[model samples]
Target: MKENSTFAPKANALQDYQFTIIVPVYNEEENLPRVEKELLAYTKIASKKTGILFVNDGSKDNSQALIEETCTRNEGFNYISFKENRGLSAAIKAGFDHVETPLLGYIDSDLQTAPEDFNLLLEKIGEYDLVTGVRANRKDKFVKNMSSKIANGIRRAFTNDGMDDTGCPLKVIKTAYAKRIPMFKGLHRFLPAMILLQNGKVLQVPVQHFPRIAGKAKFGVWNRLLGPLMDCFAYLWMKKKYINYEIKSKGC
Candidate 1:
């Protein structure tokens, strides 16, 4: 991945961190301040030392300004902003492409998932190739929540990945597996399944969920339901021809 519009990596300060959390931002100016506070607090007690990488997905708002300001004030905060608005999956793909940590995690700028709970996923990373969250007591509205449930069911039927909450943004994965994923516009919904395609294991643990305290909800009934429904067919096509191999004999 090329350097984003602007990024200042402080190697001396970042050398101690063993993990990175990618927070994808898109017109989320209202949440950046709280994201800064929560992530900084998380770094203090992360199971493995961690830092934050804010991927600005071309927000046509003040999000990029706020991200730069936060990165300047915080010790381990850094960011890469896009030149034009891309979807969430593109931001996640950018995160995977640039993250250089052994363990890479992703969270939403909306703050729906708690950063502290990253530890919960981190604890199980040693045993599984991927660790994702299943939100316990989600705080979304009744209609939205119901749509999500139906969407998840449809996704499971297609992917058969057995993940109850692929919609949950909180997740940690080995960087090796993450970087290998063939990312597309909506492939974020199929992360666990993609890992499975690589003959890897996945574990889902319950994590805390919060209602949107700021910014408008980005998705509606159409994208929440119909979007994943469409991605399912895409996943099926990829799964059929996807190849995985292990070399047993090598001389170097």
Candidate 2:
């Protein structure tokens, strides 16, 4: 394990911090090295205590091996591997189940969203239970972009979460609120809405986006469009039946 350092190399100064970035990856062998490098660089510059957790979503490739190798070489990097191929939501839920820090964050393994922008989300963690990035200028294909726009519109109309880009993978959430969310297949798409159910505040910030430099996109038309449509109805049903309350009196 890498010793947790309190001193920054650039400033040679000590600081207080506590947060974890959970990266759910599926067959991302080609991008692991770069991901490790960028995350390490970000951790060094981060103003808080930071660590990286890679959740292997039952990748059939050598992703698990590479994840172990990277963690072995990097002190701040840790990981958990699933036995079978669960979806992104399951991976994220596992991350939340295990995270012990005050704040939790996530980013995609494809490198489309910059890891450094996590600092942008972290800046507002104190004011919001969840802070997510809205891709400023997306570089995805027209179909993907269009589908996401329509899906987000439908999601907003139904859930009324008022978030413009729920698909953006970069997010920093307070661990307590994150752990309370119910896990489901497409629940990752409804994070902001789920947070709102907990009476938690969510803030969206403009973050940088880039064209994918490596690997193929995991989403298809069905997963991005049809899947979200069905999930929306599921969310509506849950929202209507959901229960919340406050205790006015208690005896100890």
Candidate 3:
């Protein structure tokens, strides 16, 4: 779990850190400033000591420079820049691999989802292994909304996860359960389902949503609709072979 630490490392164990908000960025130069501002503000008032981790998903634009700048300027801010763009799932996988905090969170670089809603997810973590958001009033076009609905319905039928909006950007998950997920291309859409495969509990709570303030949406109908539908087959395959274990006895 080695990462580039710009500032002093925590004196206590990883559990001492309450949460590390992983914001996956890919060519989101216009949104970095607001991302920094909102996340920093959230950290200030967060019930737990929250840290911001900006995962630069091989962004070719000026997003990396601004991310580095913002991370350096803030105390609890940090980041990892990939050599090449690997899409959202890879960036999120990297975040889950490196994040050392007790709770792991994810938000989009685009501010369509509010950072403050993370507090709501955190409140439910004690009762469930994963607590994700369902956008109450999604601010998207008719086409996008309908496509997502169709996709969600298809996924629910396949995985039986019963998640309304797996596409929701805001979520808080127990680090152990999160790190165990076998992430793939459309991994973000299957987070709750993956948690269930691990025999972990999942709970969804309604959260606020807004239209994109900056940068165009990275996913379109193909990725949101066709991609996830294809991933459902993969999920079925995984679920058939998924393993679960218990350490009734152990020796070092």
TM-score of 1: 0.96
> Against the correct fold, how does model 3 do in TM-score?
0.93
Steric clash pairs (candidate 1): none
Cα lDDT for residue 28, candidate 3: 94
Clashes of each: 0, 2, 0
Q: Which candidate should be chosen as best, given TM-score against the real structure?
A: 1
lDDT of 2 by residue, 8-71 (tens): 1222111233888899989999898899899989989886879888888889998988888887
Query: Which lDDT tens digits does candidate 1 get at residues 1-252?
Result: 354444556653555678989999999988888899989999998889898899988899999889889988887788888877778888898888878889999999999999999999999999899999999999999999999999999999999999999989999999999999999888899999999999999999999999999999889999989988999999999999898999999998
Write the number of the candidate with greater TM-score, choosing between 1 and 3.
Answer: 1
Root-mean-square deviation of Cα positions for candidate 1 versus the true structure, in angstroms: 1.5
Q: Give the runs in model 1 whose Cα sits over 4 Å from its true position.
A: 1-8, 11-15
lDDT of 1: 0.90
Candidate 2 stretches with Cα past 4 Å from truth are: 1-17
Ranking by TM-score: 1, 3, 2
Q: What is the lDDT of residue 151 in candidate 1?
A: 95
